[model samples]
Structure formats: C-alpha cells, structure tokens
Target: MFDKLKEKLGGFKKVLGGAIEEKEQEAIKAGHVKPEVSIKKEAPESAKPSETVKAPEKAGIFDKLKAAVLEQEFIIEEKSVKDHLWELEMALLESDVALPVAEKIVEAVKAELVGTRRKIGSDTGNIVETALRQAILKVISVDSFDFDGFVKKSNKPVSIVFVGVNGTGKTTTIAKMAERFKEQGYSVVIAAGDTFRAGAIEQIERHADALGIKLIKHQEGADPAAVVYDAIQFAKAKHKDIVLADTAGRMHTNINLMDQLKKVCRVNDPDLIIFVDEAVAGNDAVERAKLFNSAVAFNGSILTKQDADAKGGAAISIAYTTGKPVLFLGVGQSYKDLIKFDPNWLLDRLFE
Candidate 1:
C-alpha cells in the first residue's frame, strides 16, 4: 500500500547505517577503543630476537585486543544523525504527510536515536528501522478505538453516521460496515440519509438488497434528518442490532449542508459519527478530516482506497489531525476488503 513511503524509509535506513558506521570509525581513529590487531608484525628474519616469544602470551594479547574492540560502545550524537533527519523530513513531506505530523515523526526519531548507546558492530539497519517504526507508530496511534469492542458493548441498534466530502467513498464504506456487522452476528439496518443527490438512495438500496438487510431511505430532495430518524425508529421496532446511516457528501464550507448534518445528529442522536475519506487523497484528506471534526466532531474515521494508495499519508495524518483512531481501511472493491485498522499491522507492512 505505502510503496513510496517504504522506499523512502529504506533509503533513510541506509543513511542511518552509514552515519553510525562513520561515527564508529571516527571514534576508533580518535583512539576511544583498542584496535583489533595491536600485536607487532613478526620481526623480519634478519631482525628476529634470539629468544622466541611465548605463543600463549601472544594469543592472550590478541584475545584481549579483540575483546576490547568488540566491547566498545559508541553514543549516537545528534550531529551524526542530522543529515538523516533532514532527509527523513523531506521524504515525509513529499509523501503528503502533514507539516506537524512530519515534524513530530522527525522529533521522535531524533529522541530515539540521539545519545543512544550501541555496541560496536551491532546491526545498524535493524536499529534504524526500529526507531523509525516506533516514531511512525506514535504519529498514527494518537487515539486507539476498538470497533468490535465498542459495538459489542454498546446498546442495541447502535447508530453510526458517516460524514465526509463528496466522492470519498462514503456510500461504499457504509455498505462495507453493514456487511461487517452482519457477519459478526448482528442484525443491521441502513439509512439512506443522503437525500440531496440523485441515485443516492438507489445506490444504498442496491447494497442493502445484495446484503439482504433492511434499508430506510427517502426520495431525492427529502430531508436527510427525517430519513435517519425513521431508520432509528425502524431499528427499534425490528430488533436490529445496529443502524448505519449514509449522509449526503458535503464540503465543510457549505453552510447549508453542514447545518443539515447537524440537524440529523441533533435529531437522531447517533451512537457514533465516522468520517470517511480516501487514503489516496493524501493531504487533502487530512485537511477535510480536520475541517469536518471542527464543524461536526466525528468520533472516528474510515480511510478508503488504501489498496491504491502509494504514499499512505492520510492514514497517519487523519488520526493526528482529528485526535481519533482510524476504525477501518477500505482495501479493495469487494465488501470483504474493508479491514480494521491496526497500528502494528501498518508498521509491519511498512517496515517488512
């Protein structure tokens, strides 16, 4: 998924390895530790000593020198890693990482590497990768939310509203969530609350029909808030375990549409508000998430089109921007392609 970022991090690893190696060599040249071979060259035949040196004594000296060299420890100073940090910063920015997020990752890497003690000849690449992984993890794990745990414990017919700008896969994500909940043994009801756009109701109805789940929808130009309210009432009567509402996609700057969204929430009082966006949208996705959170305040986010994302910046930036966890990732076209977001899973994919 994050092919570009993976390549960039690999480059950073090489740079880090070289920097550490150079620092180790500089320490050795400065006589900070004993050399591995300190024994004097065997005397030329013409200048040999009359008495032969003891083999055991010479072997002991060689072992001591080797031990001294292997046991030496070097501290990773910030100066040595400065270039690496700069390169990392540029790489992150180019990958569409938000400014603050890029800065946070850089600072984290510095905190993890600077002044750290490592024995001479340790695996430098492994060390760099570990530090980078932890830094990225810190950036994305700002808030961790367990989707299944919340759904299991929440009251019956837990209502969730999906909000985001247009063309960010909001409808598809709603269908995916409905399938997920159904597979988990919960009866799901879908609300086609996106009444503004033509075919919005038909789009959701097709998914509901395919999934054999009930859908509550209104005709075009109908009040979206009314649709959601009706869906909640239907769920209560039908004993449905969850209600997933799909709202019309609207820009945060659209005062009228945003006001309609507020009305929907105020009237229906959903259990959770999930912002949907595309991972491939990069910095734009991050900005939209921030704006949406400021206006309506979503609980979590679902990032779609991850399978097509080469940079994978939105996943990292959205969590930090919204102070909310990424509940799910839409990986492909199939309903089953929606996978729950896990920090470790992302780290493994990026680093491995």
Candidate 2:
C-alpha cells in the first residue's frame, strides 16, 4: 500500500549510509590512528658487543596493537550531513509529506548525525538506519489515540460523526464503523444525516438493511443535526450502544456548508467527529483535513482507498496537519477492509 513512501525512505537511507561511510573513510585517510609498527626496538648502533640489552617480553603486545588499530579510534565530524538530509527532505516533500513534517524529520536526522560518535573506517549503515527510524516515528506519532479502547470506555450510544468532502466515501466509512461496533457486541444505529445529496438516504438505507442496523433519517433537504438528534433518541430508546452519523459532504471553502457543520457540532455534541477522505488525494486531502479541523475540530480520520494509494503520504500528512491521529484505513470495498491504524504496524511496513 505504501510502496512509494517505502521506496522514498529507502532512498534516504542509501544517502545517509553513503555519507557516513565517506566521512569514516576520510577520517581513516587523515592518519587519525596508530601505525602497525612492531613494539620491539632496533639494535643499538654502538657498544652492542659489550652491553647486553634486555629484549622486552612479547606479552600480547601485538594483540593490543591490533585492537587499537582496528578500533574506530578516529572521530570525524561530517558537516555535509545537512546536504544529504536536504535531499531527503525534498524526497519526503515529493512523496506528499507536509512541509513542516518533512522539515522536522530532516532536522531530526541532522541532530543525530553531526558530531555523533562512530567507528572510524566502519560501515555506519546501522547508525543511519536507527536515526531515520527515529525521525519517522517522531513525525507520525506526534498525535495518536487508541480507538478500540476509547470506544469500549465511552458511554452508551457513543456517537461518531463522519465529515469530509463529497465522493470521499463518508457514508460507506460510517457503515464500516457500524459493522465494527456490531462485531464488538454493540447494538448499532446509523443516522443518514446527509440530506443535501439526492441519493444519500437510499445509499445509507442499503447499508443499514445489509447490516441489520436501524437507520434514522428525515428527508431530502432536511436538517442534518435534527436527523442526528432523532438517531440518538432512537439509540437511547432501543438500548443501542453506538450511533454513526453521516453528515453531508461539503468543500472546505464553502462558507455556508461549513457553518452548517458548525451548527451540527453545536446541536448534537457528538462524541467523536471523524474526517473521511481518499488516500490518493494527497495534499488536497491534507489541506481539506486542516480546513475541516479549523471549521468543526474533528477528532480523527478514516482514509479510503488506501490499497490503491502507492505513495500513501496522506495517511501521515493528515494526522500531522490536523494534530489528530488516523483512526482507521479503508483498504478495499468490503466491510472487512476497514483496518485500524496502528503506528507500530505502519512503521514495520515502511522500515522492514
């Protein structure tokens, strides 16, 4: 899924390894080590016949010298580490990582490189690998959450509002969440709050029927917040555990639509407002997430079509841009495609 991003990071690793190797070679060539000459002294030029000179005992002197010579005895500072990191930073940007996130990663690598201790004339690949892993972990783990734990601990009728631009699979993502909650032994209800779209109600109705979950709706052009309120009431009356509300998809720049979302937030006071978007949308998705967060302050996100997104940068950038964790990823069209986002799992996918 993240093939492109993995390739990009691999490139960075190659550059970093090369830079460290070059610096180590430079240190070795600068004669920053003890020579391999023997410990025994030459015979005296005069009076060799009359004076008897004691020869020093060879008590592991050669072993000690070998260890000293082979040891990374020299320390060389590579000032050009910045240059390599700069290339990495550009590569990250090209992969659709946000500018701020990319810069932070580069700075982190730089900090780990400059004036750091290393064995002279030895391969520094492991060192560079560690630094790169740490940098990426820092960038993506800045904001994270435990979704299943949170859902389990939350009060009954745990409401989750789905928000995003049109055609980003908002309603389907809600249906997937409904299935997930149901699988967890929770009674689920779906609120078809997207009244602006012509076929939104029918679309959600199909999912509701298939999942055997109750669907709450009003009509086309009806108030989305009112639909959510009614859904909450129905969940409460029927002892349902969760309410997955689907809001109308609107562009971030639409003032009227954004205001409508604000009203929904004010009215329903949902537990978790999740932003849904396409994984392949790249920077557009990131900008949309930022704008949506600014408008209604979403809790996290669910990215759809992750299987098709080779670069897979939106998954990283969206969290960093909005100061929120990615709750889940929609890998395919099936209900089982909804995979929870785990930072460690993602790290292994990229680094291993």
| Per-model C-alpha RMSD | 9.4, 10.1
List the global CA lDDT of all models. Answer: 0.83, 0.78
Global fold similarity of model 1 (TM-score): 0.88
Q: Please estimate how well model 1 matches the true structure, expressed as its whole-model Cα lDDT.
A: 0.83
Clashes of 2: 0
lDDT of 1 by residue, 196-246 (tens): 988999999999999999999888999999999999999999889999999
Q: What is the TM-score of each candidate against the true structure?
A: 0.88, 0.85
**Residue-level error in angstroms, candidate 1, position 134:** 1.2
Residue pair clashes in candidate 2: none
Model 1, which residues run further than 4 Å from truth? 25-71
Tens-digit lDDT track of model 2 for 222-290: 999999999999998998899999999999999998999999889999999999999999889999999
